[model samples]
Target: MSAGEFYYDQKVLENHLISLVPFNQDLHVSKLIHEVNTHDLLKYIPFPPFESEEEFIKNFWEPVLNAPGECLYAIIDKATAKESGESNAFAGTMALTSTSKENAVTEIGILIFPAFQRTHVATNAAGLLLQYTLDPPSAGGLGLRRVEWKCHSENAASRRAALRMGFEFEGIARWHRICPVGVSVEALEKRNGTKGEQRGRHTAIFSITWDEWDEKRPKIVALMERKY
Candidate 1:
């Protein structure tokens, strides 16, 4: 169930499932564009034989930062790590796919940096994302109605994360598509590149509706407060 490993022959579509995110970097609702981009963390997520950090950042970084339907964010430790002045860093990026021009339903996506994986950080970030996305914009939120967490069937870690954050499991889309595994040069493209005969695996979908989110907020907020 570890996100770090998978058992499928075709690379799970998780590779394509990057975390798109949003956050209140500043107090103003109009300042949402200021949210951080953590795509640089993807370099560390993949296995080694990894190229220099700079190269990895250059190639794979911007797609997450500048993605058409996604937003990204970084979680810094406030205090720097001992080895360098670099802030103790983790990724807490989420993607919100708008259901309409007014953006009523926003499907979410997320990923955590390897160093910060398997901890409260992931859950906290998810809670924040949910809170910001589903709350009314009048309350400085997005007023969204639905949020989704879709993962490759083989990415048990991601599935677990969604469940832990209280998202409801929907169904799966078999043969979703293919992408690279970790940083491997090998790509798992679909058979004939058609929806037909595609060799990809299922995308496990999890979702939370606005009402359930509203009902759950008091408990989630209390849990998050305890973690801080």
Candidate 2:
């Protein structure tokens, strides 16, 4: 199948804890701005900090929205009640990027806000994405053979989460890319006792192949179902 044929019919996904929908700029920009300001969600990645909503749109959102074979979704908390009586409040963003129809593979990138981290929010959101991506085309799924999760080697939390969710460690790509430390220079100095730029990092790669998914899916489902 072609890229367009495989990705054209994007769908909304949900479970008891969270809802995943096609990202809408108008609906998500405000919440995203707040998340970015309060949380260092994009620090490990190469993306620069967002200085304004306009820059966020131009540099971040638009690129993802327009990218071929990418499906970006806004994560919403279903249990959070809003003044508008809507239980689904924007929590963060996640994406299935670098999708290849010919290879039947994709990478999952997630950015869960601070309020929702260490909770079932990330687990459920990931579970929903995995289920959608690994399900066979005949079953209304991506029919993918592999799904990758990559993060900064120094990001212990991300690496832990990847393993906890059944992604196996592949290896590290040394000096994979230059990534910002995700903090102001002062803050970085205070925390690490050195200038942020002086510290270099590597990329840790992980993956859950289709065969592994068969074994890991149930564990993930059970984890998501547990009370946290």
Name the top lDDT candidate. Answer: 2
In angstroms, the error of model 1 at 146 is 0.8
Candidate 1 lDDT over 179-206, as tens digits, reads 2333222224332344433133457889
Clashing pairs in 2: none
Q: 1-228, model 2: which lDDT tens digit per residue?
A: 111222546788988778888777767777777777767677776664576878877776666556677877888888773433443467788888888878988999998889778888899998899888887777777778999999888788999999998999999987666655452122346666665454345789999988777778899999989998
Which stretches of model 2 miss by more than 4 angstroms? Answer: 1-8, 82-84, 180-200
Q: On a 0 to 100 scale, what is the lDDT of residue 172 in model 1?
A: 83
How big is the positional error of residue 28 in model 1, measured in Å on the Cα after superposition?
Answer: 23
For each candidate in turn, the TM-score is 0.61, 0.84
The local distance difference test score of each candidate is: 0.50, 0.77
Window of ten residues with lowest summed lDDT in model 1: 1-10
